[model samples]
Each structure stands twice: as C-alpha cells, then as structure tokens.
Target: MDFSFLPKYWAYFNYGVMVTIMISVCVVFFGTIIGILVALAKRSNIKILEWLVSLYVWIFRGTPMVVQIMIAFTWMQFSGLPTISFGVLDIDLTRVVPGIIIISLNSGAYISEIVRAGIEAVPKGQMEAAYSLGIKPINTMRYVILPQAIKNILPALGNEFITIIKDSSLLQTIGVMELWNGAQSVATATYIPVEPLLFAAFYYLMVTSAMSGLLKLLEGRMSNGGKA
Candidate 1:
C-alpha cells in the first residue's frame, strides 16, 4: 500500500513501458505483414499452400504462447543472435529477438484468420470486375481486394494490438525488461511488491483504454463514410 517507492523507481517503470510499447509495435507490424501473406496463401486455391498454412495456424493457435517463448528463447540462445546498436541504444538481440519472433508469429497465426475473413467478406463481383479488365490476379488483389478488405480488418487489427500489448508482459519471463519485469525489479528493490504491480496494472489500463478509444473513433469514421 505504501507507494513512497515511486519517486525512487518510477524511471524503471517508465523504461518498462517503453519496452512494452516497442515490443507490441514490432509484433503488430510484423504480425500484420505475415498475416496478410498467410491469408492470401490460404485463399490461393492451391492445395499444398492452403494445407501448410492451416497447419501453421493450427499449431501456433493450439499451443500456449509461454511455451513457445521458452522454446524460442532456448533455441536462440543455442544459435545466438547478434546485438545491434540503434544510435545510442544497444538492443540485446539475445533477449528481445526471441520474444519478438515468437510473439509476432503467434499473433500472425491469429491475424491470418481475421485477414482471411475480411478478404472473403469482399464482394466476389469486385474481384471478377478487376479480372475482366485484364488485371493480373495479384494486381486485382493488391488494388481491388485488399483495400476493401482492410476496412473490415481494421477493427480486428486494433483488438489484436491491444492483445499484444498485454501479452508482451510474458517476455518478462525471459528477462526482456518489459513492464511486468520492471515492476518485478522495483518490487525486489523496494520490497514493496504489491505497489509496483499496482503501478503496472494502472499503466496497462491507461494504455489499453487510450488505444480502445482511438480504435472506436476510427471505426466511427469508417462507418460514417470517412466523415469527421
């Protein structure tokens, strides 16, 4: 209940917040790219590609993310990833890399289904019209299908981003120095575990709430024909 430790350890919590946002952003970016590709492949009408993508989605979705993170961490440790410097920031690939990869892959599996649903929701006539005009299949998809499908997919993508923000806390288990991990560090240093965790909960609530509000606004604009 004593939060006198805040002044001493607030910086650590702030750093944790930064790491959480960084990881979630990276996961969402990479996951969306992977999801779009996988969704397109599943819709390709190619049996082998469809089967392979289905198996991938099945495995990632069926298994626990924590287990995946642990396995990825151990594998990356064995193989080793190089640390890279971004200006003054030294990114420890050994820690962040595994978490990013695992979480992005996990998110991609789920997002693929959402993307597929969105793509399918697009009118078949739109695709046929593009093809009748001598457009290549890829071009038809790129110019005609995806743009329309994106409107349907945007809300789900927002929800996925929210999910990733919370799930990034799991990276703390592998010493990724995210929000939950920062709270743990503060707890150990201050011997006031509950307060630090409460701080993390508050921070998380603020972030998710802000994101949810933005998403609702965007959805409203889209629903209203992009009117402000």
Candidate 2:
C-alpha cells in the first residue's frame, strides 16, 4: 500500500533493469547466431548433421529452462568463473556466465524452428534460380534466400526477443541479480514482498509494451521499403 520505500530502493530496481536488458540482449544475439547455424544444418541434406541438430533441438526445447539453468549452474561450480569488473557493472561469472549460456541455448532451440520455417517459406524457385546462375549454395543463401526469409520471420524473431526478456527472470535463481532478483532483494530489505513484486511487474509490462511498439514500427518501415 505504501511506496515510500521507492526513493530508498530505486537503485536496486535500476540496476536490476539494466542487468535484465543486458542478459536479454546477449541471449537474443547469441541465440540468433546459434539458431541460424542449426537451421542451416537441419536443412543441409546431410543425414548426420540433420540428426545432430534435431537431437539438440529436442533436448533443449523439450526440457524446462529452469532445469537447464540448474544443471548448467551445477556443472559450472566445479570450474566456475572469477569475478570480472566492468566499471559500474561487476559480473559474477560463476552465475552470470552460466545463466546467459543456458538461456541462450534454450532460446536457440526455439529460434532454430522459427528460422527453419522462415527459410522454408522462401520460394524454391529463388534458390534454383541462384543455382542456375552458377551461384554457390552458400552464396545463394547469403545473397538471396536469407534476406527474404529474415523479413518473413521478423515478427517471430521480435516475439522471441520479448520472450527472452520475460524469461530472464529465471536467472534470479542462479543469483544473476536480474530484475526479479532485484525485486527479491528489495522485498527482503523493505519487508514488503508484494509491493516490490508489484513494482517489478510494472517494469516488465512497461518494457514489453515498449518493445512491442518498436517492433510494430520496424515492421511498418520494412514493409514500406524503409519509408518513413
């Protein structure tokens, strides 16, 4: 009922917001790279590669993300990371590194499917036309297929970014000090659990809403051939 604690604890939420954004950005970036590779491998027509990529997607997407984080955290404990300072940001690699890796891998599995669908949506004739022009398969994909496919799947990729933003809360369990973790710290300090959590929810809503607006604007520009 009382938000008088806001002034006293705003810094915790601010730091948490920053950490959440950083983790989400890293996850989306690395996940997109992994997904592109996996998608290409799945479509590579080599049975071995397809099988391996398929298995990876199955294991990662089939399992819950929290469990993956736990497993990765435990694994890292044996050979964990040392503290890394970055001016205002001090990273505890033992938690932050493993949290990012596991979440990115999880996002990668889902993204692989999105990318594969995008790639498939491209007309076969385009690929064949490139090949007919003596273009290497790699060059064909680079110059022709991927560009169209990325546009086709831009909405889905944006949704994935939003999903990662929410999922970053799970990193709190590993002591990564993301948004949810920051809320928990404030809850402990303020002795008012529900208020802090409600405040955190407000931040999540604001972020996702802003992201959705940006994506709509981007989609419109791309749809309009980059016109204003």
TM per prediction: 0.93, 0.96
Once model 2 is optimally superposed onto the true structure by TM-score, how far is the C-alpha of residue 156 displaced, in angstroms? 0.5
Could you list the CA RMSD of all candidates, in the order they appear? Answer: 1.8, 1.5
> What's the lDDT of the predicted structure labeled candidate 1?
0.91
lDDT (10s digit) by residue, model 1, range 112-222 = 999999999999999999999999999999999998898999999999999999999999888888889989999998888698999899999999999999999988888
Top candidate when judged by TM-score against the true structure: 2
**What TM-score does candidate 2 get on C-alpha atoms?**
0.96
- What does candidate 2's lDDT look like per residue over 111-204, in tens digits? 9999999999999999999999999999999999999898888999999999999999998888988889999999998899799999999999
Q: Count the backbone clashes (under 3 Å) in each candidate.
A: 0, 0
Q: What is the C-alpha lDDT of each candidate?
A: 0.91, 0.91
Q: Which stretches of candidate 2 lie over 4 Å from their true place?
A: 226-228
